[model samples]
Target: MPALPDPLPDPVAPVVPLGQDPGRAAADRLLGQELRRCREARGLTLRQVAPVIRGSVSKISRLERGESPPRPRDVRALAAFYEVDAQQMRVIERLLEHAQDAEWYEQFSDVTPGFLKRLIQLEGDAEEICVYENLVVPGILQTRAYARHMVRAVMPSAEPEEVDRVVELRAERQLRLMDGPLPRVVALLEESILHRRCGDAQVMHEQLKHLLHAGDTDKVSIRILKMSREWGVTPPYPITHLKFSNGEQSELAYVEHINGANYVTKPRALDDYRNALSNLRNAAASKDESIDLILKAQHRFGDRTAS
Candidate 1:
């Protein structure tokens, strides 16, 4: 009935690492998604909502995309404009508080890349992680030595200190993976990865042994995809599928390449990845057979080290 006050300018927020406050980041995304859904259901556009919230179209867009921290006043204005029920309003209020909470990864923001920060955050929140790797071992399952070698290979120009920081970050992620009972992980490694040497014989041996031990855990499953002529189709790039606890925005598909990565949220694209994962699972060796394969690879590396 009355015009809302103009939205206040957002402060220049610090560059906090994405993983620093995964819970908050997740809340921001979920809240934005809910706002966007409500707007679409009302057949309203960002331009229409902007004036009611006393903000620009871009500002409204940013709010709906969760790119910026939400203002309580703006959120209240939006809720009133949308005429949401009391129950829905309560949910929004809770999300707003969670989104504004302090994060843990703030200290590492200076060293971590934005994409990596986001990935780590997603991994942290994911209820289940499905990895399809054709290159080196997935970061979550890598041993410290293996991680160091891979980091050096990927970031050759990085300073020694920076490289150590990256390795430490990877180790921290692995520790987080083991710390709680939240994320159940399934890793599919191409058979060739076993032969692809990341470092010297000792490194590869330790890495393979680590995978063997990890596979024994109830929370982790590791399978090997053997090279075969009968295998019809395979995904061209590495894919990490993350399923979260939230019902509204439950799943995310991460496709990574040499230069950057793409986060796939579209239902159709996610379905495609799901199908590819199914095919890969069918083509891959069973867990026991995969373990044997890993053991053999470890022995080969062990023999080389002993020589």
Candidate 2:
């Protein structure tokens, strides 16, 4: 079995909380209901709640509705008003943080969307992730040069300043795999990812070197499927699976076109994607041999560059 994560450290990072957009939305609803229960159980009406904290009825209602966050002071006031201790208030506080996550991913609003937040949550909470790619070393394994090239290419029409900012964000997304507290990441790459040229020889070489580094790591595993293999279930899409330590499972799927991304969790859709993933995994080379294939391609390209 893979190494399990250490006991969660009070879980107070305030980073992306443990919910996707829909998950957060539901959490918000529950927090709202709980807030009302706490207040009503103490015989406090909306009017009494407002004056007790010197806020408006509208403000109290808004907090209960999760339309706005409960300020720290507001939480203190309410806890006192409800005759509860600070520890009891913690549950509400944590749930509201999930409501505030900017990481609610959009399918494709472009402009770098929310990759950093999504990446952090996926690594911090997940036990394992299985990823498939068609034409790149997935972001977790990308070198700076390769990442910059891919970022520049991702949104070709963005303003110059916006492009630069996004490239910086992509480069930052590689932290976990390089350092500690990483997830068990298994990747399957199509053979053509090797031959496709994203940048000049220098950047491409960096990418290949980075892939080798990833393969050599004890926990990170990668496999490549040769182009000649006749694979049966083609979803014509890219898919990723993330299994969290909390028993939460999600599929990160995107359309074949650039900029199309969706965190797929509808049961029926997940079933179809899971079937496709199982087939693709079966067709790919094992980690040991995949590294050899990648190294050979690197040598061939390097020879061409040297001559």
Candidate 3:
């Protein structure tokens, strides 16, 4: 039970690079979460952990929230204090390295909101993504026209250039669904969203066709909640759940609004979202039925275009 050096030895080079990468920042966040979990489990407060790293309480808090990248030395000191085994220490070091690397999304910083930047970081690492949409199509599944129209509709004052960048950002996110082990995606859409017109008839028609195509993917599941089926409830607004790969199997819930967004980490709140999603799934039309609905909507839009 000896104390490690307050400040671990500094490296010859800078700990953080010149560029900012949310993906790398996300790694730092994961490291911080693990550190915080360890400290709390050992019944240690931030004040006590601070001295071990020769830092302040706020630093400990920030590290835990993954607000900033952690120093390798500080991570090691924390592992020692937490009695983390040697095997996990290596993983922490690797995460620190990855935190310094640049991510593709960094290029879109101009148009990306702060909350969305963090969400993107989380999404990149998530193994499963569950989304519920009532207002519009989820960005991950949106076609280019659909995304552009939705973006412009929501932010009419946004410059055309900015609108284009936001559309590009959405397209960039879709790449994750294509790459690596495709994260299992379960999306529940309100039946009305299919009928809501974003752009012209042609745009809605293309979007619906795209939805059908996306649903065909083995990893993607799309279901629609019909208006006729009374669930005795108004389903909650858009909810996104991200499940990460870590020893603890952590999950984060994201709820977005016009003013801002909320990132929920509390177990109870997450459980509530999970249960609500379950109910919505239960009330939704079967996958085949949902596809049928999508096709019908597509044909309806096609007729509008023809007329």
Candidate 2 C-alpha lDDT tens digits along 1-307: 1221121111122224334355555666777777888998888799988887788999889878877655656766677778866776777666655454334333223644444356555554466778888767787777777777787786677787776666555555456344443468788888888878878876777688778887788777888998877855344445667666654444443322344345555565555566666777888988777888888878756754453
- Residue lDDT tens for model 1, 225-296: 987637575666688888888756788777765555667776666677777787888888999899999988
Clashing pairs in 3: 29-66
Question: Lowest lDDT 10-mer window, candidate 3?
Answer: 5-14
Instruction: After superposing candidate 1 on the true structure, give the runs of residues whose Cα lies further than 4 Å from its correct spot.
Output: 1-22, 25-102, 303-307
List where candidate 3 sits over 4 angstroms from the true fold: 1-102, 303-307
Query: Local distance difference test, per candidate?
Result: 0.78, 0.65, 0.77
The C-alpha RMSD in Å for every predicted model, in order, reads: 15.1, 11.0, 15.3
User: Of the candidates shown, which would achieve the greatest lDDT relative to the real structure?
Assistant: 1
Pitting candidate 2 against candidate 3, the one with the higher TM-score is: 3
Cα distance off (Å), candidate 2, residue 167: 1.9
**Clashing residue pairs in candidate 1 (N, C-alpha, C atoms within 3 angstroms):** 20-105
Error of 2 at 284 (Å): 0.7
| Model 2: lDDT of residue 149 | 75
Per-residue error at 19 for model 2, in Å?
10
Using Cα atoms with residue i matched to residue i, what is each candidate's TM-score against the true structure? 0.67, 0.59, 0.67
